[model samples]
Structure formats: structure tokens, C-alpha cells
Target: MTDAFSSSSETVLQRVLEVSLKSNTPVDKLEELYQIKATCDFILEHQFAKVALQFPDELLGDSVAIAEEINRNTNAKPFILGDTSYGSCCVDEVAAEHVGAECIVHYGSACLSTSKRLPLMYVFERRAVDVDRCASSFRELYPDSRSNVVILYDVSYAHAVKDLVTILSPEYPNLVSSELVVEGERCYSPGFIKRLNNDSLPPEQCDSQVIYQFGRQFSLKSGSSITDYSMFYIGEEGATLRNFMMTWNRCSFCSFSPATMTGRAESISVNRALMKRYYAIERAKDASVVGILVGTLGVADYLTIIQQLKETIRRAGKKSYMFAMGKLNVPKLANFLEIDIYVLIACPENSLLDSNDFYKPVVTPFEMEVACNKQREWSEEYITDFRRLLPGGQSHVPLADQQDESDETDVSLITGVLRSHNLLNGEPAETPSSSSMVLRNQTLTVANTNSAASFLAGRSWRGLEQKLGDTPVVKAVEGRRGIAIAYEEEGTAS
Candidate 1:
């Protein structure tokens, strides 16, 4: 926390308890809500002497109370972390390091990116939703639904899932629940499923099919393959929904909003995003200087992705620079006029920044890889997880789909769906300026060769010059045609 917001650990705990009492929140549920018991158990199991408690802005009110409870129950010393360097969703490992804490216990909504150094124990916030009504809406929306109905939700709505299952189990026979078998924090998307393979299946999934759980385990009544299952998401139109649609575009999907109490069929709107993403990819290929924005340091495997991106840019014969700012805003980036494109290495949730209003385009690390890798082809598959982009995690592109080396030059890299077409007027746009198409000036200049001291040593820095009218200054003073002297009298007097 900042200095202004700082309070004694005991005072903070007392204030949090007061706030908790006014809300009529149960004291017993506090342990489950914050996962206090599990977090303490984890500390004991690991025998960590020092533990850090990280909370988002909204969760700060409960931080002190949680820390006190942890300190009381376990032998570990619990310390509270205030503000974070980047997005609060990421574990504030740097803050923990300041206190010499061993690990972090993160609370509230998370991006679920793996922590690089400090091991993170995430306690996602669970808000109560009307499961009975939500299930009724699902039942009425799709009467005689297929056996394969996979249920997914935002981490916030994770609590209602069990009740939703109990209500819909009788009507929907094959209700599927998923737990991510992959490493790191679980993302809010179905793309994690594509990363699933035979070798990566968890212990419970060993004998079962190749299907891995997305969030938590929802045991199917009977064994069934992942075929025509309709994905029913209990969240909003966010990153999770975008990822879910991208992975299972062919399958029927419906999103039921617990807040609105409304259910609607998700059409090809998700497809529109695919086109936008492709357009961004095409634009990235034309960029000369790419700014790699360190969107997140908290997500696991971020450093690996940054290294891969730099190498990719180098291989493509382009230049790249690294930037690290906790938060990214258009104005902050606009200062760098030389940068043509910015590739964000952020959490998938915060990734895909729309640079339409920006002076330059912004892209993701995945897009950077696509633009630079000659072996990569434009595909429908988009990777949001950086861990998946690692060497072993990289998905193999089919040989038939890979582009040949010779064809790379002949193909128009900038030719995309938006080319030659004007969105405003229903007519062809004028040709782009030559300056826009020209290659960046890669020539480096020597500072000493054009030094002011060397040039002005012989020349006079004064007003009106010479036989000719006032002349412009030249680089070298060796052979000058015209001269001016404003301080002639002062020089003579001195």
C-alpha cells in the first residue's frame, strides 16, 4: 500500500472487521471466500516462514483481517502488500521480495499468468448468483439439448456452478465440467482445451478421454467424447468468451449472464474479432521498429516470450526495443514517434489493445511471432498463453500449410482485407504516400562528424551576414561563403 493509505497492521485488521460486519457477511464463509484455511495449510505444508498477502483494490478492505487470521492460525508471519507495479491481477512478487517473503497469497480476480519467481496461491473471489434461475433460463433456451453440454463460467461465478449442475443434471444428461490439466493459473477460455493432449491428461483423466477440464471438475454422468457439446458459459462477453469461441467456433455456444438474467445465442460476432486480429497481424509485418511493451511481469513465462519475440524480430530483419511500464496508455506510448508498432506482452485478458485511435498500431506477442516467423502462416488458431508459445509448447503447423522460402518475397506482406478499400466512402482510396512505403533509414550518423563546436569555432554566431542576404548555416566551417558577427564590439572591448 502507498504511504498515505498505510495503517498499523492491527488497525487495518480492526477496520476490515468493522466493514465485514456491516455487510452482514458470515464470518465462517470468510475462510472459504478468501481460502484462508487452504492458504494457511499450503504455508504449513511448504513450511514457509514468511508469507505475503496480496489483494486487489476492492479486496484491500479484507486484507488486514485475512493477514491477522493467517498469522494467528499458522506459525508463519503474514504481511500485507498494498499497490502493485502492474495490473493488480498479477502476483506482486516484487513487493513480497521487499519484505523477504517466501510466497504470495493472491486474492480477488486474477489474470492467472504464472508468477516468474515467487510461487502464487490465488484465492479467486466468488460472488453468489441465482443458480436456480440461471438453470431455468438454460433449460428453456435449449429444450431437448444434446448430451454434451459443457458448462463454463468466469472465476467470479465459480461458486454457482455446483448448484447449476444440481438443477440442470436431470434435464441435461451429459453435463461436462473441466479442470485445467496444464501448468500455471487457469484462464477463462476454451483454447486451453486445444493445448490438451494424451500425455498432459491429469490423474483422473488418465483412463478417460483426451478432454481436460477448463476450470474445475464436473464429472460427466457417462463417458463421452468431446464432439457436438454446446458450451454454456455463465459469464459476460470478455476474454474468456472470446477464447472459448475461437477454440470451438463450429460448436454451438450460448452465454447466460447471471447479472442480466438473460440468455442469448452467440453468433458469428466472435468471427469479427478474428478478422480484426488478422488485420493487426498484417499491419505488424510491415512495421520496422517494434516496441515490446512489458504488459505483465507477473504472468508465468513472460521473460521467455520476450526473448522469443526479440529473436523472431531479429530473424525477420527488423529492429525491436523493450519497454516496461506498469500500465499502458495511448498518450504514454505516443511520445515514441519512431516506433511503428507496439507488441504487448500482457495477460490474455488485458492483451489485444485496440490501437485504432492511437498514433501507431499495438499488437500482441503472438501477432509479433506470426509476423516475424517465416515458417508461420496466418491461421485461425490464436495463442493467448505465453507458456503455450514456449519451445515445447509451440504447436506444430502442418507441412502443407507452411509457406515456402521463395514465396515470402513475392507475396505482398501488407496486402490485407482493408487494402485499397475506404471504409468511410464506398470508393477506392488514393494511393499511399511514397514516404509510407519506403524502408526506415537504418544508416547511423557519427555525432563528432557534425559537432557544433567544430563547425562554430571559426564561424561567427551573429545576425545579418555577408555580401549575400542572410544565409543558412552549413555543416563544416572550412569553406563558408557568407559570415555574420553580432558580438564584434564586445570581442574588441574584451
Candidate 2:
């Protein structure tokens, strides 16, 4: 018994040393990229019975190492998940559910879409940055400027933020850093914001505000307000930068790359992304068949959003089809030629698909709402995350229990808004005898083709004549020049 105890202790110590050596750089440098201590602390605190540890393909090598550390320190069982069904950035809830994981610890770059069944904890990838060099570069770029500068950064460079502020404090007295605010029951990830439009919350809490920064506010005053503060982002130009620009387009912003140690103005790129989004929104308005691409099922409240979309499309007198494939690629979606537009129900990061290369225009849920809802005027306030579609609930509730407002007769389908309308083209639209109108909404078929329905109902239509009731068949005469005059020859030949 004594020998066995000694062997086990030595083994544990060996594992600890191995991990320590692997991450043996300065504490600041080691923690900058991935917060090993914080991750373990979170796991221990949650006391989750089953935990799913997700890592991107590039970071998969560190999975065993991370799991071992967590297992050694806590009682939670860590299941290493790989090759997400959808975009690698989005949380793979399907993978987590396989192991019956209660929560997910996502590592690396994440789209930050809300989770469905499993709550998620994100460990953003951190890259080392030379704080002094960045501070020096800023001084050179804006030497004459005296306004307060707000430091915004990609999740990957979150660790370098503190060092940056410290290095630049002496030179720039008003340098401020922005931090994301998270308030929810689930474990909050770095980039994800809480659901904004949840109706269950009281009126005071129902207001949608995704990004909250704790830096100086922009202002036009002689003194610096948050509005007047110029943005100094520390990351490469990509989705995060694009989203940030769209969120604060009016403010002056600059993109700085810690990897390359270079900076560039992002006004042109920001405008271009906004312009493309606006164009896609306008094009979706004319679509007859809208495809609701179920890009993710694991996202919390996705089903609610899907049902809402179906009703919204129907009210707008447009046919909607649901497509569910883990990954939404252009090649796969192009197969559905009938769909004029596709609204991707994906994480906020991957939701705004660049349709420049796609055969059909793909828009986000926000754009879909704008296009399908006639009364919805275009607004600068844009929301792409699925959680923002509805309020967060305590637990997943049955669809039947949820209240649906579409049953109300006073609602107007043409305008896609709720309002009382007694007449349509000077005729009573409904007089308690409008069964057809009611049935139209209830029995709407997936396929709008008349021939397909007729063929299924034992009827002979032109193309399907061979399948059903007898219809005279014409024989082809390849060598005959007067075959066009078949009607004249029919009576004579009989």
C-alpha cells in the first residue's frame, strides 16, 4: 500500500512538471496566449460532471495536455472534441451532447454564438505582442492628436492589452482599454454577448445591447467623450475588425497588427463591408423562395428563431424551406436552384457570409427580418447573433407552451406587422367565414408546384400523364415532315 501510494504521487508530480516545463516561459508570457490558471479555476468552481473540451484543428495538439491538467485538479470528466460539424469557430454542441457534457470549454478562435443545451466557456487564443513597440508606433502615427484613444482588440490579443496600456501610460495620459460585459446564467465566452431581445425579461431588461465597453465614451466636446475617442485596435483585419467597424462606423478607427507590427486605416474596408451587407438586404426583398439555412442547432434559442422565421416568411407571402447541414458551403447550397435567397441561422461571427462569391445571395437573420417584414424600415442598428432574436429562457421550453402571435386575426400579412384591417381591395377580408384564408396558413405545403400535388393525388397532368389516369399518348414520327399537323391526321387515321 505504501509503495503504491508513492508510485501514484510520483506519477502525478511527473505530469505536473512536464506541463510546467512546456509552459515554462515567464508567467506573463505563458498566460498571455492561454490562461491556464483561469481555465482550471473555472472548471473547479462549476463542478460540472461532464465537460466537453473543444479545440480547433491547429490547437488539437494541446487538448491532451489541457485535459490532463484539468483532470488532475478537478473531478470533472473532460471529453476532447474535434472536427466540428459546422464552422470550426462555432461551438460544436452536437459533439458535446454525444458525451452528455453539461458544459463546453471552447479553446481558440470562437464565433461566440449562444449555446443551446450546453453552456460554453471560451479560452481565446493569445499571441505575444511587444507593448513598447506598439506604444511607440501609436505615438508616431498620431503625434499631434490630444484626444483620448480607446483601445479595442481582437480576442486573440486580449492578453497584450494590459501590457500595452502600461507601456503607453507615460506618453499618453488618457489611453483607455475596453472590456466586454457578460451577464447571464451560462458561462460567458470572450466574444459572445448576451441575448438582447428576450421578451420574458421585464421591459427595463428587454432592451438589446450586445457590446459594452468600459472606456471613455465617444464625444465631439472640446474635452474627450466616448464619441471623440479614436479606436486603436490590436489585431489583423478580419471578421472581428469588420464587425467592430460596422458597430462603430462613425468613429475614427485604426487596425494594428501585433504579428507584423504594422497599422493601417480601416475606413475603406469598413465602408465596403457595410455596403455589401446593405446590398444583400435590398436584394433579399424580391426573393420568392427564402432558404433558412440551419447553420447551427446547438445555439440556444435557435429553434425559436427558426419557427419565427417560418411565420415571418409565410406572413410576407413567401415560401421558406429549412436546410440543415452542419457546414454551409456555397457548392452545397447552390444545389437548391429554387431558393432565391438564404438566411443563415449561424453564430454572429460566421453569420454574415460574404455573398460576393456565392451563386445565390446569403444574408443574416437581421437582413432577413428587414427584407421579409414590410413595415420594418432599414435601421443602422444591426444584430446578427441568433440569441438577439429572442430573450434567454431559464431552460428549453416546449414550442406548444410558448405563445405565438400569428393566430391573431387583426394581424396584417401583407405588411408583416400586427394591425387591424377589415377590408382587402374594398371587400371584407374576413367575416367569420374565411376558412380559405385560415386553411391557407395551416396547410401550406413545402412544394408550391401544382403538378407535383396533382400527381400525388392520382390525377393526370401533362408531364405526369403516364403515371395516372389514361390520357391519349402521341407517337413520334422522326422521318415525317408534316408531324406538326397531327390534329388533322387524328380523325382520318381513326
Model 1 earns a TM-score of 0.70
lDDT of each: 0.64, 0.62
Model 1 per-residue lDDT tens digits across residues 54-160? 77888777776677678888978877776777777667676677667788887776655555577667667877678877887788767885557888787777666
Pairs of colliding residues, candidate 1: 1-82, 114-300, 178-213, 178-214, 179-213
lDDT of 1 at 255: 81
lDDT digits (tens) for residues 1-494 of candidate 2: 00011111222111222233243234345344556667667777777877878878887656666676677778677777766777777778777776577888888876555454666687888666777778877887668546577788776776677777777777776666655433346756533233332344345433422224221122222433445568888888777766666666667887678889887766575566777887887667656568889987666678888988886666655667888887667789766666778999876667877877789999987787776654455665566655655545221112221133242233333345433211121121221321223223332322122221222344233333455456667798666344665744354454
Error of 1 at 111 (Å): 3.5
Candidate 1 stretches greater than 4 Å from native: 1-29, 180-227, 394-407, 410-494
**Candidate 2 residue spans exceeding 4 A from truth:** 1-34, 169-174, 188-227, 267-269, 386-494
Model 2 whole-model lDDT (C-alpha atoms): 0.62
Instruction: Give the Å shift of residue 427 in candidate 1.
Output: 40
